[model samples]
Target: MTQHETPERGARLGRACGADGSGTAVGGAVVLLPGRPGMPLLSPGPVRALVRELARAGGPDGLATHVVQHADGCPERAVDEVVRRYGDVPVCLAGYGSGGLTALRGGGHPAVNSVLALAPCLPDEKASAPPEPVKHLAGRQVLIVHGTNDGRADPESSFRLAARAKKANRSTCRFEVHSDGHRLREHRSEVVALAVDFVLGSVMGGRWSRPVTDALAAPPPLGLRMPLASGFGRSLRG
Candidate 1:
């Protein structure tokens, strides 16, 4: 840990690996943002595995991780926590579910090279709007990976986010849909492999393209958009 760096519980950083153990420290960093019902970073086993993958893949030294209080705290607090610890490092923001919501809310981090979200949750245009349009994330680079079978957050939301990013002129914003669910515990290796490819490619300036478009075109759950939150309706009425 760097001097004056405050660590989140279980927060530590190391290298990320490539096949055959040949990897370079591209000064890349990755932070995992937890989803709503805001579980600790350790609740899901995959996150730990992700960290281990980075170590094996040759990630930079001492990356910082943070746990926000559900989605209640200001997004700036999260960004500040990360910046305070890892200065000017190439950072990737990742979150699952509402954790993605919170991570997106944070802006103005010049060091963030990209964002990786899985099964992200978006507040209906009701509770509040994102500080910037979802497409703003594409201004840099973003990788959105969601399972087609996610019931809590239909994949369409992720598609809308991807479209927004494209509208923002982000050519590198890629979205991939897997045949799994919200947790991704079902298609663990497949999901992780895609994520690894995304991170490595994004950092190394490799050829970029949308990972899955046909899947993104798939229909959303029937009647899923009908139940608008009453607060959202009120906000519009106001």
Candidate 2:
């Protein structure tokens, strides 16, 4: 894996790490983002582990994986950089915490194929207010995974956003990690594995699991309310 940081005239310098340390990919590229600026979310944590695992699982054709650090506390700029990096290659946006919100916000990028938001920090809008604008994700697939007991960012807020997103994009889905917190470290393996499945199938030509398909196709609240059960990890392995 190779790492690099170049100064950009207007944007913050994004520290990027690649899976193979070179070249583009036919299987496509994934851009992982952190919630806050300077947080090592792109380092040797669950997201990084997911990047490594995805590279290994992407077959001989290989997948290009990148960790885009939010050096300026703006993950969308990181996404923008990754989109520019991959050009026509489909890009999957995966982000954690505040970065998750960034991924959803960046789903409108023309090059984006899918978005995986792991416990996003969404704005708490009043019930009477208009839903967040999600028309941009009209043709894109979106998956939101939030912890039921998330303290830092209210789980309800994400659910509301997901509901709104589902309306705009029928392919939108959300998974609830029961009793987990904002970090979702309790079931990190399960969460990461789910993310991998979503990215592979959505960004590349990989097969989509039955569960994923059902969630995306199901009507409204059902898909948005799907639970990441204890057996979920086993199901993915199977």
| The candidate that achieves the highest lDDT relative to the unseen native structure | 2
Which lDDT tens digits does candidate 2 get at residues 24-127?
Answer: 34446677776666677554336766766676666334456666665544456655655454446677877888778878877787777898888888877877
What TM-score number comes out for model 1?
A: 0.65
> All candidates' TM-scores?
0.65, 0.83
Clashes of each: 13, 0
Query: How much is the lDDT of residue 144 in candidate 1?
Result: 65
- In model 2, residue pairs whose N, Cα or C atoms come closer than 3 Å (at least 3 residues apart or on different chains), thus clashing, are none
> Over 4 Å off in model 1, which ranges?
1-26, 60-75, 125-132, 172-174, 203-238
Report RMSD for candidate 1.
Answer: 11.4
Error of 2 at 97 (Å): 0.5
The sequence of per-residue lDDT tens digits that candidate 1 reaches over residues 20-104 is 1122223445556666654776456356566555455444333333333444633554455455544445666666677676566
C-alpha lDDT score of every prediction, in listed order: 0.51, 0.73
